[model samples]
Target chain A: MRYERPTTLKAAAQMLAKEKGQAFILAGGTDLLVRLRTGFIEPDLIVDIKSINGSKTIQKTATGFKIGSAVSGAELGEHAALKKAWPGVVEAANLIGSKQVQGRCTMTGNLCNASPAADSVPALVAAAAKVVIVGPKGKRTVAAEEIPVGPGKTSLKKGEIIESIVLPKRPPKSGDAYLRFIPRTEMDIAVVGVGVSLTLDGKGVVTKARVALGAVAPTVRLVPAAAKALIGTKMDKAALDALAAACSAACSPIDDKRGTRDFRIKVAGVLARRAAVIARKRAGGK
Target chain B: MSGITVNAKINGDPVEFICEADETLLDVLRNRLGLTGAKEGCSTGDCGACSVTVDGRLTCSCLVLGAEIEGHNIGTIEGMAHGEELHPLQKKFIEHAALQCGVCTPGFLIAAKSLLDKNPDPTETEIRFGLAGNLCRCTGYDKIVRAVQDTAKEMRKTNSRKGA
Candidate 1:
């Protein structure tokens, strides 16, 4: 195997594009190294992206924030502006693993790992986040929800790397939160995860909302039905009930030792409702 | 496969080593450099027995590739003490009997030191969450938590005396 640390995205893309055997992009190596150790994958080439300039920065743009693909979860939490603007996203990213893992795990790595139960993806989806994909061809931006197609699968074309994730600036009276259910308190994968983001008008009625669920399908799901339930209401019990029902109806989870299918489906709604409540409070609601 | 030579700083000293492209930092530290302070408990990130600080960020050596540390600074358990005197956390751990098997002690010490560095006065709950990555099966963790608490208190007093 060969290890190449390219200082430019184009060079990295070209190396991956030209590789004949299996190749994996090394960001934090939190997931890749584990896969290598478990005999789960053997790649002929490893492209380390950390050397790329500005790959570890969190830049604030007039539009939103551009989180470099190599930025660790710990760094994200330390970015006060970014964390204050997108608490749900930062919290979700921080919840990926333990404090040690947070020092090495990147949101882009979590998204690209394409695990249906990835803790950060649901929050990114709810935030209506877009990823900057760079490749030999050029650059393009797509919704975060479009990246994961299935368990352990991504829609990124060969050699296309996610350079950064762009999160839109939050409007006034907007808040978001992510919640996940795990058997143990820490160092455990999510059994069911929910992320809720909403904006309220002057009257405190939800003007816009996005609801996302993870660990319930092959890919992280953006449930328009659940969001629709919250858009026109003040998130009262009736609105929250409708939101929960929609979330429950969206689940097609599988039965695993961590959680049964029914349990996950039931917990999905429960978590969604609870998350929306936290988001509402954060938005300065009563 | 040919070896990749990397230049890095470990335990406050510059070191150079050659390792395979796929070799983990844990293997590089233990096998190549003979800095076995970081152990391979799980060879996965789940267990923090291989905990170390890469560029002052607490990380699992098992999860990092050796090639990634070419220009980084690494802090292992071996760096926790002065020439003769033990670090406050180290002394406190012994005074409080924080270990039974001693395998997880290195990881616990590194993690505790990192925690105290970030937050000089962490609460009991904060200490527990900060050290959640390192698992101690022998000690029920009460003793370990107490040791960290005592170290924090002692360190605060010493610093306050200097300030005075």
Candidate 2:
């Protein structure tokens, strides 16, 4: 195996394009290294992108923030301004693994790893983040929800890499939260994960909302109907019930050893409702 | 696929070595260099038994490629002590009987040190969460937490005296 560290993004892109599909882009290496040790993958080329310019920075835009694809979870947690703006996103990225793992893992890796149960995916989807993809063709942006097509699969074509994820500006009275049900306290994949981002009006009614669920579908499911249930409402029991029903209605979880199909479906609604409540509270709701 | 040369400072010593692309930092440090304080608990990042500080950042060495640690500073369990005196956390661990099996002790010490660097004084809950990555099955974490707390108090006293 050859390890290539390219200092420039153009050189990195050129190297990846040259290797065709046999090269794996090494981000934080929390996931890629394990696969290498276990012989799960045998790529001839390893393109290390940390040396690339601006690959590990958190740049603030006028609207919101652009987080580098190689930024570690610990780095994200230490950013006071970024944390204050996107606590749910930071907490979800922090939930990927243990403290040491957090020091080396990236949310981009979590998303690109393409695990249906990734803790950060649902949060990114709920936040309406856009991934900036760099390829041999050029640069283009896509919704985070559209990146993961299936389990262990991504829509990124050959020689394409995610440069950063752009989180749009949050309006006033906005808050977001992510919660997941895991059998163990730590070091466990999510049985069901839910993310809720909402904005409220002066009357404390939810003006806009986005609900996303994980581990209950092939890809992270964005439930528009669930969000629709909360709009213009004060998130009372009736509206929360509609939200839960919408979440349950959208689930298609497989019966895995960690959780059964029926159990995951039920927990999806419960988690979604609970997450919506937390998000509402954060958004200064009644 | 040839071996790549790595240049880094391990425990204040500038060291250079060649490692394979598939080689992990923990493996290189233990197998090649014969510094075996960081144990490979699971070979994956799940277990913090292989925790080390690369460039002052707490990380699992197993998750880092050996060649990728170029031009960085590494702190390991072996470098925790100076001369004949043990680090405060190291002494406190022994005094408090923090380890029963000793397999996870190095990792816990390294992790606690990492936490103290960030938070000079951590609450019990903070300590628990900070060291959540490093697991110890023997003492049930009571003694380990106490040891870290005691070390923190002692270190704070030393700092205050220096100020005075």
Predicted model with the maximum lDDT: 1
Q: Over all chains combined, what TM-score does candidate 2 have? A: 0.98
Looking at model 2, the pairs that clash are none
Window of ten residues with lowest summed lDDT in model 2 chain B: B129-138
TM-score of each: 0.99, 0.98
True contacts kept of 2: 0.81
Candidate 1, A1-286: lDDT as tens digits: 9999999999999999999999999998889999988999989999999999989999999999999999999999999999999999999999999899999999999999999999999999999999999987899999999999999999999989999999999999999999999997899999999999999898899999999999999999999999999998998899999999999999999999889999999999999999999999889887
lDDT of 2 at B153: 96
Error of 2 at A51 (Å): 0.8
User: Total clashing residue pairs per candidate?
Assistant: 0, 0
lDDT of 2 by residue, A1-286 (tens): 8999988777888888888557899989999999999999998899999988888999999989999989999999999988878888888999988889988899899999999999999999999999999998999999999999999999998788899999998998999999999987788889999999999999999999999999999999999999999998999999999999999999999998889999998999999899998888888775
RMSD of each: 0.7, 1.1
Whole-model lDDT per candidate: 0.95, 0.92
For each candidate, what's the DockQ?
0.89, 0.84
Q: In candidate 1, what are the lDDT values of residues B45-131, reduced to their tens digit?
A: 988999999999999999999999999999999888998999999999999999898999999999999999999999999999999
